[model samples]
Target: MPPPALTRLSVDELVGMAGVNPWELHDRLMVGRPEQIDELANSFHRAASRVAEGDGVFGEARSCFQGAYSAQSGGDTINASPEVTKTANDFQLGASQLDTISRSLDEVAHALTTAQKTTGEYVGSLNAALSQLDAMAEAIGPGSGANEQQYNQIRAEGAGVVGSAGDLVTGVVTSYQSTLQDHMALAQANRWHSGSARRGGDPAATIPGNGTDPATVKQWWEGLSATDKQRLIDEHPDRIGNLNGVPIADRSAANELSVDRDIHRVDDVAAAHHVPSDEVLAHPELYGLDASAVTRYRNANHVLDARKTDANGGRNRTYVMAYDPLAFGGKGRAAVTIGDPDQADNIAVVVPGTGNHVNKGWSGAKDSISLYEQANKADPDHKTAVVSWMGYDAPDSPTDPRMLTPATARASGAALADDVNSLWATHDGSPQHVTVIGHSYGSTTVADAAAANQMHATDVALIGCPGTDLAHNAGDFHLDGGHVYVGDASTDPVGMLSSSPLGMPGISVAGVDGPGLGDADPAGVNYGAQRFKAEASDASPGSFVTFADHSQYYKPGSESLYNLSTIAAGHGDSLGDQGMLAVHRPSVAPVSVPNPLGGILGPDRINLPNPLDTGIGKLADPELLRGGVTDNHNH
Candidate 1:
């Protein structure tokens, strides 16, 4: 028996079927007559297949019909024959099963159609959401995050501005203080001398000469009573030298007293006496000296020697060949000279590194001259001079420790320092500031010298320094007001690792605080201080002592070189920034974004009429719709 047609039959429809009880149909069709129900399902499926193989909407409908037919195969209509009442009941069961399956198929078809519609709507929503996001992104521009490049750039610029401002302020204050101090010192000196002179009984007595013409004043002074003259001499010990030739105080005072009245101008007197204006104004005792005393003093303080010994045992030259009588017959003779020998300025000395000798290979003489030339070039305007002291016998290479020990090197440096000081004293000059430029082992020598107070250079600059165990802190090295500058190019490997265990272990020639000199920190180090960077182009090639090292003490155009020159010339404390920002500023304004999501959403998503195109929820609109469709239709 064929099963009953079940298409269009809902659960209620099945219950309303002719001569059918809902409970009985469920029990009989679902549980019995399976064969009869299968036959009816097969026939229905064949019909549906023919329809499904067609096109368009009809094909979809056919697929739905096929599902209905398959359901009917499980209906209870198999044994509908008069021979058995049980078979008849089974046939009824098959018909009931077919109806139930048909209804299920119809429901499924409806769901699929609905899902397809939903998917189309979802696609539209997704497109709208993407459009909204794009608009927002456009409005925001880009730098909303804290890590954005624009934000970082702005911060850096701000910091630079602040730092520059601070530096300017500091410079101004320092200059003001320096000027005030100079004025005070000058006032004090004048007051002390003027008061003493005024207190003396006779103005002429205080003046050290009569009011007569030059010749008469000399005769009157010569004719003074021995007791009166002796009393005057006792009062001014420096004035006693006037009876002979030596103006006891200094050349400036002596020159002033001799020619000032005759020339009627202090400047002329200064010029004639070869004395500085300050010296003349500060001290009056050295004015007017007799020839004999002057000659005696000149001989006693004369620096240059008339005779000299050749290094190779030959005739000696005037300026170059004078032998050091103090170190007679020694292995070497050290000659020291000061440039711009003036008391009001600063000083510097450039020490060459390895391969420094007197012989043809690496002569200390030649290296010293080269360094002097470089220093002059570094700062032509500064009143600074370079002292080229080749005290130690620098090695061709790092061969032996005995050849270079701090103690031994220090002894030689002390002698050299003594000579420098003596020269300064003899010339009536003193260095207000001093800097030492030491390259490689020369740095070692400088450190030792400084430790022993030999070279009282204001700042110590160590280039390609192997090691100096000086105290880490400025106080430790007794240079509280002084600075230590270390310059090591990033490419210089030796500077990166060299150290001394005996002295300041954590200090390096560079400015860092470590086992070696510490890392390069520019804030604390300036002027003759270590500058950690590449070698300046203007630096002399020999400034770098090591063969593989090209570290120069003061390159012509290098920062280190300029700093040394400025400090040595007494301008180190007052140099302002040289429009460095103009030189370093970028050529173009950088493209930047301030906010990431400010533009597109009108700053408020829910308020927009088209929420899908302008809201936070719009972010997932596309994916959300697609998901809804899949959930509705996949089953």
Candidate 2:
């Protein structure tokens, strides 16, 4: 049904309406207690945030309780996981409804305040016009001459003025009514008691499962109505925040909510344990929090802080591309981008190596920012984004047994492939020039993703790599441009793992993939990858060069960093002119030396010299080791 229009007021009626004190009404609406509505709205938002945090706490408690239950019971015999998950979902829905109410209140208050101010102005104008008309009528009283005609014309114009004022008043009234109706409907739709009904039961059931294909998930998400999408974001951010195929901006908004909830959860847990929130990190066990909870707190705060203040003196837009505080057995997973990846013409995903977790993830932020700056410098006309993707569970220590096999890397590779492909699925416009860079063990993971999982990328760079696992040659990656770049420094111990006879044994043991053992190096002469010069220090080893050189590929003002920047910015053709290519060494096969008594030696011993050795015996200046650039591991 059509809505009724506002009544048109006559001149005399407008005069009556304008009798109220315009100044008083203006003061009341603009500067008085009505202004406090903003504060009230803020309070409701804060409460909603607190409720969301409580949901996170419930999730953590569920995890802890499930662990205890599993230890006591033979298995998950009680189905505690589902029950806890549902409870958490319910709490999240409540929080969403609270946020909805807050927004509605804010909208109504703003609209009414604006209308009251406009109405006051209209009333003042109308009263002045009517008063002037009265004065002119009195000035030409009881005359039938030119003065009488002028008075009549003035009265007619005055009526027109009154009619215009009536129209203006009508607009304000109509706007006020519309605002009230819209907000009232929203409030009713998100009522506390009937949230489930308003939301149509579980929102999770309406969306694609987390394990769905990235392209399929993207299609499903795009197919949703705008209203449905926003409802999910408000009510079930946990589901879409880290979902593979969602758009970057929407994921960022959802993850930001997730971060806030995590911070709130930490505080609540601290309060429950009678400890200060700051002390939660010092003694997480006191709150029944896993070690990962501390890291989660740190990671969440890191993202929040980045939003408030610029880091490394750069004002690049920051976004939480992915966040999962309880993922990967509580080690956690997260990805922070220096610029919006979806908007950038060039994008680089920097995957770190061992000992990186959510707690120490901020270290990679510095590298990401630096790489972003350099990549921009390389191609000023095109926009670039760098992502520090700590999205996989890495070995906590170099000697950890998980490094002995390709299982972790393979699994992580699949995840990485999905993440990269998700970016391709959700990016804006034409195909982006995407580069995936990995260091040390992360290189192995990247290789697995590209070779076995069909990761979508234009270029791939591996630095300080121990091995490539199933990816033996550049062709194995199947990159868009067939460009597989390698940045292996001669003094890097880890990078030389495949070439060094001492380090090759362990890699060979861990190189098993299907029925065949994979080669241990992508930078070897026979590997067919395009090598770039990455010797940040002297080619010979020093006190710090052994392990420290492994981390220098991304260092500022270095040749390797420059070459990487060029590749990331899709300007790789200039690398040759810039003298960034490493010297090519011919592949050397192991030669057999026949012994005079061949039976005594079992067979002829085989040996070959590796051109990419770390030259452990040849030490560089100690001063260089002491005062030179330190690795990120130290930082």
Candidate 3:
């Protein structure tokens, strides 16, 4: 009775415990293999035996037996038989064994439950580790070309195992935090150490007064040569202050081409007044123009300059003239007059040739102007206006043609023609007849202008022409309806040269016809009807027949110049000299017709034919052969 020991508990007491299960739990515990079952049964039996020994109830029962024995028989005699005693003892032992089995089963079940939970937690942690590894691997995988399929498989498996518990979440967070810290450390090291080293030395670290701004220091450091900076940093790391904060000099701006300033100065007053700087510089006559003309031109220049100086300066009108050498200017500005602006009259444009310029004296402008002035003077009854157009960039010499080709000459001529037409339009004037008198290379310039449709001159007179493209007839150049007069002197050396191979080859003259320089009279020695003689009076009487050079065509009093003026003034009938009569005839009159020479005559057998027998017919006829066709003739 000192304390009821646990061993004093009866079987009923043991069975009454809340956690104990007698059958199902005990069965599980005893259901193992015989060895394990036996060991468990033995342990249970031992525990029961101890309990029975200490139990107050069982001891009391034993004491009762002892007392009964003493009461019923004096110390030696037993109340019951041995068999019954053995049976009761056996039953008690069996009950004790069963209780032990039941207790063991309960303990086993609890242990299994705890172990399963612990294992699940451990598995979950392992899975989370794998999952974090997979996530980190994916984030740090190859950037451009990665094996996506393998990554996805790893992610899916890891996610499945990690989803089971919270411990895995903690592990993943810890791993990510460690990885982030490591990456940040690496990045900082790269930026601070590696980048600073690349700059040769850290100015902030070495120099006392160096600014803390890394960018500023870096820019200065970069300005140094790699080898030099490295040498300084390595040789004197402590003395780096000597090189710190060096400033760079700014570069100066370079000179550039500008269009806003004038490029030339004019010394001659006459040139400054009358001629543009470009022309004056190009020619020699600008220095020597007449004082009177220069005065008039200066007045005009002042008016122009004043107008241009005004607010509405751009509205001022001006004219640009470009003349070539053969464009007969003998002294200065050519005196050209246009009369009766309202009347429809004859208009003549005189085109000179090579070696023309402004500063060469008045001869450059005067000669061409005189031709026109003379034409107008010769025909006072008729309204006539003459234009001494120096509308070409003429060659400076015979060899200058090599520089001034037909194509270049044409552009200048076309521009001049356009200006001329504009002037005519502005003045309310229409030339009833227009004639172009082209001399020397000016003939070629005129042909090009006409070909480009830049000139509407009714007649084209080519004097001292080297030759045009022989392949082209007068019609091909748009001068078919108009008179195309070719004047060349027998004395002219250019007249002797072959004028075939006409079109511009890359550099050479090709397909030019020989000189058909005589008068365009089939009755005459030169049977080419379009070729006309350079008049003897206008030229030197013996010059055309003797020298055969090009200059005689423009001699004063020469019939060639006379015929040119006469035709230019719309008076073709006035040209009655031998050369003129050879070409002149009424358009309506019938002339002798010649049949084609049928035989293939040898060069020696070919004889001179009559002018009427040749291809001479009325100018009205569209189909008449004025000259040889371009394929067989020189242009």
Candidate 4:
């Protein structure tokens, strides 16, 4: 109830009032049309029901997705399910509030209409009494005793009528006020606002676009209110899920939303084509399913399955740092972290080499977990985060000719640099000790990143590397107060392509001069990289080296893994004598060797160790099993 429309009046003035004012009462109550409120309530209810339908669809789709991962078990569902459920609840809450408002309006409207009618009846009685008084005054003349008495009676009756009408109006006003107050209190308690209301358009539209500096994005994200942040996540998750500058937890949440949406998108396509969701991924051709849809489905499931694995083993939490299931012509790209990179004291970004994609998530997940465990073991006092980044479109096969060129690495290097720079931007406190580890062709990619794309890292390790075409020496990496490290097994054919001390004619021509894939061997004496022991002891006597050595660097309990873990944990100096390898630089000049069977120009044997006896010893040739000796080992 608002204050009276008119000021306090004398009793005579009250009697003189013409009629009750229902318009003023309605205006003060602020009740809109009841029909319109009902419509709004219906809209809310429909939205709530739609959300429930979406929830069911995701549940069904998740079942099909989980089937792909486990034989008979189900994988973890989307982490966004709880948030989705809350969103549905919010919709239902809106409907409930709308209903209450509509009913309250109806009640107030009825109360005011009834009060107006009752007040009119009282006014009618006062009008009739005044008529009678006027007649009596006319009949009895000016000073008549009867006229005076009649006049007094009519005045008293009119006053009574006014009092009754006023009291009735007051009662209606009080009831309306009580109802309004209760509604307001409920709204305040629930923190209720119009769910569909927004001052502007979607908040996500205001976010900076891709390729914006991650630091700039971080600042923009921080400036938003919590409500706006949640609104953006709820409405437009894909915009920021894979964005580099966002916090890990928020990115995880946003990626989860995108994962759920991806599942729904794929399932929707399958449904449109009358293909069963469970069978759509296996027989994508049956429904004319696009490759990207299938890829998105598989990648989404991979993320869920990884989380399930961690949950079952009580391992460190897994966060999806990057998830783009539809990028790169269906090859897709993704990155997952074994620990929170922002909070960890040491962080390692592990880039996979050739033959990797989002579909092959198990390999990356295993590597990430293994590296995380090793890093934790190396420096137990400090926490380490390892991110397995399969964010590039890696060549499908190791033998692919693309491996002989820096084109692919160059194309993908900027993305790697941006990701690394983003880590520094989003770190929690003082800058973390960041290490970038690249295996096989991934090393070349890392080289390109640092050399041309402005990658910023503290330390870099390249293992089983073929060559670094862009980076001719360790200094080309431009590490911040840290050294580049190389781990090449003597027998590893791929590693030999870059670090072979023999400098064999055909090998050099094919690896360096011909395709020019890697002209700069990081393990060479002039390259200035710390050499680490990654050689395996199982080389055959007759054969130069087995291919098995190529993939053994990351094996647990091995010297190479130990050294890598130590460096990743920020304890590179603690590798001691056993882990470090001495530099090996064979003379570049060829020598005429008088072979028993034929004459050939071989590498200078004086500087090259016997591959069979010493296994191409990292130090100057050790006293060989055949009695040969060399001195002057350099690390």
Model 4 per-residue lDDT tens digits across residues 603-622: 22312323431224333222
Kindly give the number of clashing pairs for every candidate: 37, 0, 68, 0
Q: What's the distance in Å from true for residue 277, model 3?
A: 17
TM-score of each: 0.34, 0.59, 0.36, 0.59
**Model 1 reaches what TM-score against the true structure?**
0.34
Better of 1 and 4 by TM-score: 4
Candidate 3 has a TM-score of 0.36
**Residue 595 in model 3: lDDT:** 19
lDDT by candidate, in order shown: 0.36, 0.66, 0.40, 0.63
Question: Which predicted model would earn the best lDDT?
Answer: 2
Cα deviation in Å at residue 483, candidate 1?
A: 2.2
Give me candidate 2's TM-score against the actual structure: 0.59
Q: List all candidate RMSDs to the true structure.
A: 50.7, 31.7, 55.0, 36.2
Candidate 3 lDDT by residue in tens digits, 420-494: 443344333343777777676666667656755456566777776654432144653455256667665544544
Q: Which ten residues in a row have the lowest lDDT in candidate 1?
A: 626-635
Candidate 2 lDDT over 166-259, as tens digits, reads 5445544444554466466556655564434434655445454444455656765775678878888888887788877788889888898889
The C-alpha stretches of model 3 lying farther than 4 A from their native spots are 1-344, 361-364, 401-404, 427-431, 479-481, 498-529, 537-549, 573-579, 582-635
Error of 1 at 607 (Å): 68
Give the 10-residue window scoring lowest on summed lDDT in candidate 3.
250-259
